[model samples]
Target: MQFFASLVRSVYAATILATTGYAPSFSGDTKHNAVGAAKAIESFHPESSFETFDVNGIDHPLSDRPEFSLEDAAVSFVQSRLNITSDAVAFRTGYANDVIQHAYIHQQINGITVANAVANVAFNKKNRVVSFGSSFVQPSSVPSNTPSISVTDAIAKAESQLAGEYNGHPTTLEFVAKEDGSVALAHVVQIQDDDQDMWVEAFVDAHTGDIVHLTDFGAHASASPVYRALPLREQNVTQGFRTIKNPQNKAASPIGWHNNGVTKTNNTSGNNVITYVRGKGGARYTTPQSSAPLIFNYMQDPTKNPNATRANVHAARVNAFYVVNTMHDIFYLYGFTERASNFQNTNFGKGGWGNDRVEVSVQDTRGKNNAFFYTPPDGQHGYMKVYLFNRSVPMRDGALENDLVVHETTHGITNRMTGGGTARCLQTLESKGLGEGWSDAVAEWTEWTNATITDWVFCPYLKRGGFRIYPYSTNSTTDPLKYSSLKTLTEEHRIGAVWGNILHNVYAALVSKHGFSATAKTDPKTKGGNTVFLHLLIDALALQPCNPTFPQARAAWIQADANRYGGANKCTLWKAFASRGLGIGAANRVDSKKVPAGC
Candidate 1:
């Protein structure tokens, strides 16, 4: 529950003009419509929350910077439209420092800024307004010579071109409708190489209505070709050991929780990077490929061979493989089942239980941010390191360790997909709880598919685990806040267990009709297509900038969901769940207030 609180608080924003119950005072000569729009936003506070969507199991955070104001948008739109000089009326919002942020767009003639612009000028409550802050550029070009083209039509063309190149690269674009009912292209950005790249920045030629000088940047280099064949050392298993112990157990548990072996460096065509060597005994050690000869398990003992058939060893390899293959670009995994400090202290810095996965940094072997930990042992986050603990061995007649592997791997996949960020906040309580609930759902689904549990549902691992996140029963549907009081729970472990059960129910219902292979069309006209629901959840969580409450979380989810699945998507899931037994009302508990009126 405390963990849930951390998740919400860190992932999860005000108003004014309407406070007097009067329209904002403005110079009679200025455009009042823009002012009205800004006041409406200020009154409702549009940039308060965020959400996300997913593709498959990938995450994509939708950030809503509360700093945006109607004044900002107006100033920007005006600056670009009027081709105003560097110094204008000092268009700044009064509350710029409090809740508003200054947005700017620079006019680049070649590569440098020829002129900078400010946007969203409005008096704050104090009337001082943004006297000083970050500067934003307004469009300064008056494109009267260029032939006018509809922004919507241009965007459609761009989108069609981009479809062939997305290749898992996340992207974004800003579109505004023109007076002629055509779309105007503002800016296009794409997330590439773990950074944001601007593809285009322009203003519609006011006179000609044609696109002026649109630029594209930050396209990703094609992914390096994957070498599907095993490395040269696979056949050699001489580095086997009878039993292993952590020699550094009395000391720090070797950097990352997932660090399994020494850091190995290699170079083929002048390109080189450090790689991990997972040892047979589980104890981690450091080594460099350029300096030391590569050590294989078979090198240690000719008689003893590392057995991939063994559940523990197989699970370790699978985990290792996932780290190298899937998330290799992001992190350097060390031990499969690494441990840090025993408890939550400065020395340990909130490390998870011994069985959790540990992602360490290759650059700093002993730095604070070096190792990122994940726990829960059952959901998408839990699967991050489950293979290290269970080792995929069969304890019963019909048991397989792949369940745990898939479960933990799901977490890794989710984090990588979403870039592991947080979501926005909300006024409602249900959103925060659902955030946890979604993760639990991942765990429950993974477990059911990977492990051969009799019931194949959540909370089956505990005694009296009859579908309660604690004493609260989410199954009852009467209380959507079932897991909200996890902080006050007498016993917290049951919180995750219970939530997992509820999520399991959701998954079962979804799969029963859609089939496990069902895909989300992503086109609004289609039904039951959002194949990326799991990815959407993770992406939403990753985008959360601060801790999130259930209500806030619901808002973020709605935003992300609609952004990814469109407006009517809420019903797609609701109807599916109702048919599965969860009922439509409970399934549709997500918050819709934070989103715009229609979308």
Candidate 2:
């Protein structure tokens, strides 16, 4: 059976000679197992638009009777329905959020696994199999497990096909199921180049010492999103970049980053955003058109004076790409559905128009110590420009600052969802201030950690203190801002501060009562004060009228709670709003810190 991605092979002008060693050969005369398992599954489920799979027969409950484990059930299912023998064993198990569990079972050849012969089975929290896929090989003849070439020689042979320094990850030996239903024992090697581009996994046939299959990791991007940057809470300690695979909410980005169902981009392009650096005065930088981990370990030398050359441009683009896609995935859980006209190149027929993916300009040059987002209506591209901050000795990138990326991204979210994807609702003076406030509030929410509740500042790395006039704090003397504070404030960011801080107060109160959940950022099913606050935050955007004032937005929050949680959070919402001087009778820039009669 066919498995994995399209294999890329290098052809030299001169005929390549194999390292002469032992000559273990496959008994080509032996007849391999044959079945229509993949076709059978396709016949069973005709309507499901399945992803790329060797054999995917899924999206339905496999058995009505619950099983203890998905492995046993999947193996049995393969044997009975897919016409596979009982030589399959569980390879790995992954469980997600106390809700879904996945099983990876590979076909075995004389107790050795066929690495390419993979089958996946998944179950919901109920322990019933929900999805099943397979790459079990039906070879014409099975090869001998004994290898003619040694593992060391196999490694050298596989390395000859690619250009890159070996990334110090592991190398192993396993059975490779070749095309046309044939099997070969091969040594698999993983390597990447100096620039951290061209991540490759090559499979060498152990019998003939020929490079059997090759996979460019950049070609077939993985099914999840990963990012590396200083987290929102981190300071200027300069730990360098870390490889973090940020969680992709299933409902939001089904294919992870760098994909739009039919095609995959090896660079920073994806369904939600296309990330790149203009490089100004130099060549643009991003991952090349090859499967490679977007890893950047560039370090500046203290011996030389700091300049633009010292900045890690690749890392900046990747960081911006990570934040943009992550924000898309997170807000999508809180009512920013495709029907709501979120940024996306393709909606997968879910709803809404297409061709509106966000375009990210990393390390932009238009401004200093700041970033901006320009959003048009639905079906048009949204632009985010993150500039460099010259405040530091080596200079800092706004893309490295998580809050700035988030604050800018929220502009797209609020603009699209505010007036039914019109992108014009928040153009008035009051609404513009509210937009800035919402952006900052969302940024503050994302930066919050479960360890402690402290005042949140906007883009703190740029300055010794904070970006805003005062940090968002619950203490009266520390912030001392009221709903009416916007009356005298002429600037939008300051006027927005009043709104952002009030929401911050509300967020703190809910966290005190229901506690915080770090997982709530991506997992909407998580139950916590932060989750409730965000649910209301995004839900209220749709509920409130365009150009709404403080009181109107507050009432929308109450109504959103009533709509989503059956009014379970009504009292808590009332108290949080009241403490922020947005009580029932408060209106026209009044700070009436009063709840209902009972409260």
lDDT tens digits, residues 356-412, model 2?
899888876667777889999999999988877787677777777777888999989
Q: What is each predicted model's overall lDDT from 0 to 1?
A: 0.29, 0.68
The best candidate in terms of lDDT:
2
After TM-score superposition, the amount by which residue 195's alpha carbon in candidate 1 deviates from its true location, in angstroms, is 33
TM-scores across all candidates?
Answer: 0.31, 0.63
What CA root-mean-square deviation does each model show from the true structure?
25.3, 16.8
| lDDT (10s digit) by residue, model 1, range 97-153 | 574334343322222222222223333333323322222222223222222445454
Where model 2 places Cα greater than 4 Å from the true spot, the runs are 1-227, 232-240, 260-262, 279-285, 289-307
What are the clash counts of all predictions, listed in order? Answer: 82, 6
**lDDT of model 2 at position 586:** 88
- By TM-score, how accurate is candidate 2? 0.63
